[model samples]
Structure formats: C-alpha cells, structure tokens
Target: MTKKGKKGPSVTAKAEDRHWHGKRVKARAAKNASRTGSKTLGPRKPGSSRAGAAQGRAAERSSGATRRPDAPELVHGRNPVLEALREGVPGTTLYYMADSDERVREAIKIAADRGIPLLECGKPELDRLTDRAVHQGLALQVKPYRYAHPDDLLQGTAPLIVALDGVTDARNLGAIVRSASAFGASGILLPERRSAGVNAGAWKTSAGTLANMPVARCTNLTRQLKAYQDAGCFVAGLDAHGGSSIANIPAADGPFVLVVGSEGKGLSRLVTDHCDLLAHIPMFGHAESLNAGVAAGIALYELARQRHT
Candidate 1:
C-alpha cells in the first residue's frame, strides 16, 4: 500500500490477520505438547483479544522500547568536562586522551572522586565519542538536559528574562546561557520552533553553567513577549539599527526581558513589533556586526551593571 510520504510494506488488516493466525498455530502446538506430557515448554492459556492487545503493549513497554525521540548527550572539552562533574551532571563515563595535559589529569582525578569509570583512549576514539567536536583532550557522557516550562520563569517576583529569536547555533545558545547566569538573569527563554534547543554542544559551550540556568521553551515567542509586557515587564529587542542604546535604556534597571536575534537574520518582524523598545549596543569599530553570543553578553552586562549601580 502507498503511504502518505512514500510507498512501502503494507500496514493494514491483512498484515494483522497473518500475525494473529501465526500466534494461534503456536498456541495449538503448545497445547499438543502439554497433552503428550512432553518435556518441551507449552504456552499458557490464551486470553481474550482485548487482553492480548494489552499484554502486547505491556511487553513492548517492559522491553524498554524507544518510542520517544531522545537525542544523545556528550559533553567535551576540559572546562566543560570539569564543570559538568562539578555540577553533578550525571555522567555515565569519562574519556581522556593518552598523554593528556594537566587539565585532563585534573578531570581524571575528579571523575575518580565521583566513582565514574574512566577510559584512556587515542584521539580517534575521542573523536568518535564527541562526533568530531573540539574535545580538547577530555569528554563526558551525560543525560539529556531537562528544560523548564515557560510559566515556571514567570511566577513569583518579576524576573530578568533573556529570550532568543531564531538563534539556531547550539554553541551560541550555550554562550548566551553562561552570560545570562553570570549576569543574574532568572532564566533563558527559547521558542519552540526555529531556534536551537539545549544539547550537548550547548551544555559544553556553557561551561556547565547550563546546569544552574533554567531554560524555558515557549510555543510562540512573540505572544509570550506580549504577555510579559502586559504583566508590567519591559520587552526589548536587540538590533543593529534604529534602536535605543543598550547602555542607556532606562528599563535595564527594572523588570525587563531582552530578545536577541539570530546572527544572520535579526529579529523577525512579529517579534520586533512586540518589543516595547528596540535596543542596540553602541559600536564605533569598522565591524558591522557582532557574534550572537558577544551581543547577548554585552547587553546582559549593561543591564546587570545598570541594576547594580
């Protein structure tokens, strides 16, 4: 039968009929063996159709089926590995290249302290483990990151929220999280679509600051920004032109949410329109633009400085 996307094996009543018939034949064979008092194993009495279906489902679950899509987690680099161990990121194993540097040696000590198994391997093995990322001589296997709900960040007191708009690079996301954590932001918000989600690369890039920072995902970033504005929080978007200077924004001292855009594409029109103010970092150099992480760090530092002073 033709499927929605492409044609493949038939998946219908005929296929199911064949499966049940095979089960019935096996049941008869088991009954014959029991009647003859044979040493061979025999099947238990079959149940109703409904019971059989439920049992099948239970068996599948008991077998630890991978029904959900879960991404693998691998944290690499000396700083990330050390930080992950310090933050208790639930590492399963640690890998260090042979003839490692002092940093990797220190990592091994920490891993041993935590009772995590360590493997000394060559560069090729480390490369395969980290998927060719810059491992810097150390790697750690970690569990998938758990993200927070948007409402979790909005409760209780007003928060300093940093929202991302279409930032697809995982490394950029991690760097932003590190900066946000350092600057006292309550949490980082990411849209459910068209944005990078937290992953091993991001976790590594954050230098394990991701363990402390709560990342919340939103269905619609613009809609959420509007809700924040309604709740007396100033909503601001960062852009390259025609906006208030980040250093002088009065809202920086108050409850505020900063929306940062992708490096290639600035904020989407819908997101930009929802902002109460569009702000930009003052630039005098010949460079036209800054990296997404750098931009976020600068804006966060300004807001933090304003709040402190």
Candidate 2:
C-alpha cells in the first residue's frame, strides 16, 4: 500500500526490499568496471573471453605464473621505439598513439604501412604511459628485452669493456654508459645485486647508447673478471688515489677493460687486486674527488684518445 508521505508496508519488509535494490545497483557498477579494464596494451582489442578470463583471474589471484609474455609490450621513445618497429616487424608490428601527424603520427603511419596495427587513445592516457616523455606523442608495442653476452660486443672489434663494480645509481650508470659508448667500448658488465639495471631514466641518459651497447649481468664479479683476464683483456681499476696517471699508458699494449667502483668507496679490494693497472685522474683543484660518472668519462675518453692514434 502507498501513503501520501510514507509507505504503509511493514518496516521489516521495507528494509529487505531496500537492501535488495542497493545490491542490484552495486552489481551493475562492478560489472562495468570489470568490462572496461579488459583492454590489451596496444592495438589488439579482444572481445571478452569470459571462460578463459575467469581462469586467468583465478591464477593471478593465487600468485601463479600464468602470466605469460603472451602479448607484446609497449616501448616509448623516438629512437628505441623506432628500432623496435623497424626491426620487429616480421613477427608483429603495432604502434599506438593519441596525437596524429606529429612524429608519433609518422611512426604510426610507418607501422600501418608495414601491416602493423595502429591504435588511438585520448591525450590523457598516452601521457600516463610515457610519464610525460618526449615520445613525440608516440609509443610502439613489441617483444620483451633480449640480452646478449659480452663477447657479442667484441665481434670483429677490439676488446674494450667497462665493469661496474657497484654503481647502483641510474643517472651515474646512464652517464657512464654515454661515455662508454663514445669511447668505442665493446660491452658493459655489472653484478646482479648492488648494481643498476636498465630503467627509463637510464635509457634517457644513455641517449640511444643502450641500443648499441651490449650489457651483461654477472652472477659473480670476482669470477667474471678472471674470465675476461683469461680472454686476454687487461683490466684497469679507476681510483682517486691510484698507482699510475692514465695519460702515461702507451697505446701499443692494447685491448683492456676498465673497472669503476661505487661512488663513496673508491674500489673494493678484491676488484682492485685483479686489475692489471690502477689509474687515477689528476684533480688539480680543491675538489677532493670527482663524480663516478665524470671520472668514468675522463677515463673512457683517455682510453678512446689512446686507441684513435
């Protein structure tokens, strides 16, 4: 029954009806959120595969490894993304963007003409993926990162390598990488722990140097340097107070690797002992020491200068 101002139903019955209605509204909102979140990363949008989706959700909830690299991942940048699109096309080439007719647009056209999918998004979402990157408003979705061995870098080239002892800082690593790339180095080696790996900032600092440089993660540094020694690459350690001035080293005895230790501590004793030479940059001014990155640049340039002549 209805009233002018209030319903005439029993209080218990009214409460039960209100509760049921609330659940229905909540269920509809939840269903929409679930559906909207099902989009794939790049251009490939899949229809809701409910049966498999439920199983995949269950596996994720249990923290299992159903997580496959099943779909290609997105890479954002002008050069790296370009490299992936140009090199990765045979398998799958899909480029996505929000803004068209810019560099991003050009990349999109390239991908589309190459038979790759090109998807669009609103400006807000594209910015979020790149974190305000200078993507030229472009990003390419492709396969995972593939690592190569140290020897690969030395293919038909001289042996010049940089071994990062414990440089955990990404900027330092990146800056050092720029130096390494300019100096005609072959590869870079870092320990698995207490060292930095490739991330966004490092990539930016590397400035496409990463694309050319071969990097390897060693399980054990002490053992790995020995391997380089066995391969006939003389190892040199850089220190603030070291034995020899880097300039004096003649170019005739060539093909070497340089080891730079952590910023605070110049060199771990173990790593320094293994080096065939310990060289220092002569800081004439009052500054006690140089930044790990700056020192690395000087050292690398010294090596490069020696080799060029």
User: Which candidate achieves the best lDDT against the true structure?
Assistant: 1
**Model 1 spans > 4 angstroms off:** 1-71, 98-100, 120-123
Give the Cα lDDT of each candidate. Answer: 0.70, 0.58
Which digits, one per residue and each the tens of the lDDT, describe model 1 over residues 233-301? 667777665235677675465557888987656778888777666666766665657768988998899
- The lDDT, on a scale of 0 to 1, for candidate 1 is 0.70
Error of 1 at 262 (Å): 0.8
Off by over 4 Å in 2: 1-97, 109-117, 130-136, 139-143, 153-157, 250-253
For model 2, the local distance difference test gives 0.58
As for candidate 2, its clashing pairs are none
lDDT of 2 by residue, 71-128 (tens): 2334566665565455432314443555545656566767877777666765566565
Candidate with best TM-score: 1
* Candidate 2 TM-score to native: 0.62
